[model samples]
Target: MNGILFEKMRFTCQQSGHCCCDPNIIVTLTYRDLLRLFTTLYCDFRLLLQKISFYTLDSTTSPILEKQMVLETILTSDGKVIPGLKKHSKKICVFYSRPSCSIYSSRPLACRNYPLAFVKEKELIMSTWVKNSPKTCPGIGKGSPLSQKNIEQRGKRFFKEIEKHNQVVRELNVEASNNRPLTAREALWTLIIYGESEYQQRQK
Candidate 1:
């Protein structure tokens, strides 16, 4: 990743809701992200399922894009799956309302870390603007300079959650290979259950 230094950048959300509505972007979710939505929406798993889209990859998937997936591909009976937010028939994010995201406070990490992408190298955190962020996005170079400490904190937390999510997927994939493969719904429920257990443990 060609990352910029956080200290050299400046950003403040313009709130145009363009990112939320962008058809080109797929807002993928980690287990924690899904759990956040589950609790935020009052534990309505059925409602949550309706808002999720399982992107199934086949031979047509781009090699570079496939390599960039942070989470391991889940072996579901349906196919190799990556869960993300479902878009409307018109291709806007399902949670997107007129001028903003309805779930802004509990938005997925993909949305929370928008405009910037973070990666850790050795002991350092590196950062860069998301390659697909809308060119017309007014927030890119505007507002006060960003805080490096804050950026690092978010980056670390982001990767910590990703690691936890990856562990769950890895175990699920191994189990699928050893036994019968999971259905898409089954894999999702597994994630939700795992996330909830982790959350409860943290509360202790």
Candidate 2:
């Protein structure tokens, strides 16, 4: 994770909704993201499913891109899957309602940390602008200086959720390789159940 110090950077969301409306950007999910959506949408799996889209890699996909996706995304019988927010016919995010995200309060971590990506290195955390952020993103250099401590706090939480989600995916992949592959739907349901259980345990 090669990146600059968070203390040197500045950002303020202009709330233009460009990230949500950009067709080229894919809002990938962690289990915690799905869980938040699940709870926000009344715990209805059907409704949750409607908001997600499974991206499958095929022979036409470039080997390098495919390799990256396999390393970072989910796997299902359908293909190497990257479950993300579904786009409408016009290619905007499904949750995009006019000027903002309809579910902004419970939006995924990826969305919450847009324009900036963070990773821990040795004894420090590094921050960088996301590679896929829109060129016209209005929030890049326009706001007050960012707080290093706050950035670190958010980064810690972001990576923690990602680690837990990756663990679940690894377990599912092992099960799939053992001759009991899961369909995309089954894989998502597993995540939902696992997330729900974790949420319940946390309440105790």
Q: Could you tell me every candidate's TM-score relative to the true structure?
A: 0.95, 0.92
Per-residue lDDT over 46-108 for candidate 2, one digit per residue giving the tens place of the 0 to 100 score: 999999999877778888887554125566789878688899998999999988889999998
Lowest lDDT sum, 10 consecutive residues, model 1, at 129-138
lDDT at 63 for candidate 1? 82
Instruction: Give model 2's clash tally.
Output: 0
lDDT of 1 by residue, 1-204 (tens): 688878888889989888877788898899989899999888999999999999988889998988898776888899889899999988999999998899999999999999888877888889888876748567988888899898999899888988878888989999999999999989998898989898899999
**lDDT comparing candidate 1 with the true structure:** 0.88
- TM match of model 2 to true structure: 0.92
What clash pairs does model 2 have?
none
Query: For candidate 1, what's the RMSD?
Result: 1.3
RMSD of 2: 1.9
- Assess each prediction's global lDDT (C-alpha) against the native: 0.88, 0.83
Number of clashing residue pairs in every model?
0, 0
lDDT of 1 at 138: 77
